[model samples]
Target: MDDIKAMSFETAMKELEAVVGKLEKGDVPLEESIGLYERGAALRAHCDDKLRAAEEKVAKIALGPDGQPSGLTPVDGL
Candidate 1:
């Protein structure tokens, strides 16, 4: 949980999974569980933001009539 903003989507996702696993086992102390839950929420939000950015980029890909990616078009409001 060191500078989560600097973590890549993959790294954040992996950490989030670990946090969820610990929480699901129901064995962690209350204080630790709360910390883990908060971190998991932050990680989930970061992942969502990354995915949304990816979707926006994908939307800008222009396809030719032959159904192949021709180029990237300028996305509105991007």
Candidate 2:
């Protein structure tokens, strides 16, 4: 199995999509299908985590006293 933790979000999502397509076809053997399903679940979780982290970063934007956009605030616990 590939090191899923090292995979970028885009790469993990693409792999997860391919896994879904294969599973949908119902052509793989039972054992292989099980493995693929497990990997897909992991990828899905990883993607979700990455998205949540990104959202947190986006949420930390700072504004000036005039209400204009300034910059991002320091994201704690990164």
Q: Give Cα-based local distance difference scores for all models.
A: 0.94, 0.92
Which structure among the candidates has the greatest lDDT? 1
lDDT of 1 by residue, 4-78 (tens): 888899999999999999999999999999999999999999899899999999999999999999999988997
Candidate 2 lDDT tens digits, 1-78: 458888999999999999999999999999999999999999999999899988998878899999987998977876
Per-model TM values vs. the true structure: 0.87, 0.83
Please estimate how well model 2 matches the true structure, expressed as its whole-model Cα lDDT: 0.92
Q: How close is candidate 2 to the true structure, as a TM-score?
A: 0.83
Those runs of model 2 whose alpha carbons end farther than 4 Å from true positions after fitting are 65-68, 74-78
Residue 30, model 2: Cα distance from true site in angstroms: 0.6
